[model samples]
Target: MERDFDTTKDVVTNEVKAKKSAQAKADAQLWVVASGKGGVGKTFVTTSLGLTLSKLGHSVVIVDLDLSGANVHTSLGANPSHMNIRHYFEGAKSLQELVIPTTYPRLSYVQGFWDSWTPTDFSYNQIQNLIPELKKLRADYVLVDLGAGALEAHLNLFKTADEKILVTSPEPTSIEKTYRFIEAYMCHSLKENAAPDAFGNMITTLRDHRQRTLSKPFSFKSYLKEQTGISYTFFEALSQKPVRLVVNSCRSQANAELGHSIKSVCHKYYDLGIDFTASINYDNAVWQSVKSRTPALVAQPFTPLAGQFLNSCKHLIDPEELRAVV
Candidate 1:
């Protein structure tokens, strides 16, 4: 029988290097829409962002990978016959055949295959397995509304995204939770599955902070640095992948400015500058359409909020950005 073994270490290293080189050539813009916590209107942001992009004539597909509660269908007000990501994974249905067109002709969706994928379900290998199917869509933008929280699966989507949009409203509690979420997220992004003792200790410290009586002197930044200092690998990931912070539910420019504040804070720590784009006003039409199971853009395309979202799409896959440089 033939042996399944590598000829030599030199050959193995060369093969590994070649694979990385090949991967570098296969870059596609995967925009991951995520939040540290749920109920911050992440799905709405994902839907609007995809809708806006499609209107700009870019073939856009929003993949609802929210395994816990797959409501991208309800958000869009469409009753998909096959709302199952599991089927796609089991080879029962091809992703191409799974494309469910919405009110917007330019937009379509790939609903979550798994209805009960917990934190464990967001697997890099499983998600990677699905890419060839997604690649067939080959749109200018592949918008992914990753499941909520700071689970490895959620962070993986953030890790793999070409562009990341972190959304949050202005409520103080929401802001604080979002902060904790981002810090935990970035901490993990810099280091995936670190030592057991150290990881457990960090979680304990975070819990302690949450338990503190009143004064919250301890900071997440200090906590991370104390545990894991910036090293070669950390800096390398930061330099390669940066995130953009987006503020939604702006009652005024002050609400929009909150995004800038958050960006400034991230810059102070991460040395990355986040762009503040596309702030939408409090539109009752959003909820109204939700009751009727309709996408706000389709139900009220002419709303001011709708215009802001489409304008965001214009900037997201800007035509000028795609123009070849001489």
Candidate 2:
């Protein structure tokens, strides 16, 4: 009777595990990680998050979409494969064929081209075509590392993601650039979805006005009221995409406060709710790991930075407040 009871318990445990595996696959998420500028640890964050998610038993693919400077392969201590995004663009390979397994189990990579042969003009139609194909990839989380700056292609990729994450450092310039990037994203989204005449004219007018008055701050709410016939609530609801911010290389408590300050200012000025999800501490181990081409989580799993990465991933999985507010 005791032997039979043990067998039943093992069977139940196996069944539960199988159910969770199936559910995780069914609920796959695509996350796009972008930054306003380079040297803000965007790739590090992307690789670490991918490793963390995979370690948590979720299959992950870290795609390098930084067309100008693709280096995600170096972050994972792997050499670039012949099959990359360039091949996909050249019609020599499918998106699935571009995937190259990394050293880490359950973690794959789709390398981008780093040479001069990289495609210069990625049309919107191409991006639209790529999105559905990317969704078909076999991974629980597809993390795309976008190029620095707010280029049209980068913005489109960010918009396509299920979760858009912006990485910024504690520096003032980085913060300012991040705000501008968010503004550009919101404007692009508005132009795409909102009525062409009204929204487009409003954006054009606002650009000219801002250029004319550099000293004055532009208020999105005020512009909406004065320029468009659209209701503020309806417009806000239409533009209500939740963006997650991760403050990288934070050293002091003041840095965390600065992140919150940026969030408050964005809400007040842009009427956009920004979720400041994680503050990664400035750790020497991160640099060491980068230098060695190993992920920080693998190099220093017990460090505070690793703990923060795990916490950030968890928050991203189910940001309750962000969901409720959005």
Candidate 3:
């Protein structure tokens, strides 16, 4: 495992600091992997996916952004004290200085394993600073495993990256939460720093009929259409954003259909983007990886589950031109 923080001053833009020599075109694409809720094999997928991608000859970095309960190390068999995000958080180094190589060849980890960092440790402004820094890491892929739900911090970080993957299982509750997650993101994104007023009467009507429990009521769609103030077309714009998903713990091709099912729900009701992604099968070794303190990709290389990890990467590989250094 080789971890190189020697970021060349080669790539410089208002977005980057002027560096010296041009480095190999960074296949380094930053990705935010999150689910509507926890226990969806987030850390497992994160660790395994990074290892698999690295094995494919792509340098991979996994940021254990499971902020409050960062279990990425436990799953990856990494030493908790072997220089992590805490080192950078404590003002001991720059982002480049904090990358920790993992057991997988060319794989590394940026851990936020410390729950004690608190809001005071790094201000909201600090997160804004860290975003670009992480983006500039010299690797083929940066997988950020966010804590569940759509909070201001989580959303900001996830949305800033090159791709946003909403991780969810196929269960009823998981599907509903996924919708709720989309609703929240789409609504917030639509406002564009403004407020969600429902454009007045239309919003009020929707709220009133939200749980009318009547035989026939104003549907959320009709509620939107009726609102002359709020353009339905504007809501459709969120569908154009760069977003996708990965259905975890899948069992078969039928299980793979969950992604499209959630896509249909979001497209029909919320009018959001849920295309361009992949899924992981229900592999028992995933549990073993968790229990045995190993990454499934590295632990069970020949399994069907390992193949899914590679598929997930293919689902997210970005364009070489967009990531080109300035």
The Cα local distance difference test for each model comes to 0.71, 0.81, 0.69
lDDT of 3 by residue, 83-179 (tens): 6676676688776777877756788887665645554233567678778778788886788988888776676776666777788887878877777
TM-score of each: 0.74, 0.84, 0.78
By TM-score, the best candidate is 2
Local error of candidate 1 at 260, Å? 1.3
Residue 129, model 2: lDDT of 82
lDDT tens digits, residues 110-194, model 1? 8774445445375678776665566556565678888777777677667667777888888887788767767766667645545
The positional error of residue 205 in candidate 2, measured at the CA in angstroms, is 5.1
- Model 1 misplaced stretches (Cα beyond 4 Å): 1-28, 113-120, 192-241, 269-272, 321-326
Q: Which stretches of candidate 3 lie over 4 Å from their true place?
A: 1-27, 115-123, 193-241, 252-254, 318-326
Indicate the worst ten consecutive residues by lDDT in candidate 2.
317-326
Clashing pairs in model 3, backbone N/Cα/C closer than 3 A: 9-19, 9-20, 10-19, 10-20
Worst 10 residues of 1 by lDDT: 317-326
Indicate the residue-level lDDT of 5 in model 1: 48
Ranking by lDDT: 2, 1, 3
lDDT of 2 by residue, 168-287 (tens): 999988988898898888887766646768876777766776577535766777777776543455345534557889999998999866778888988776767888888889988877
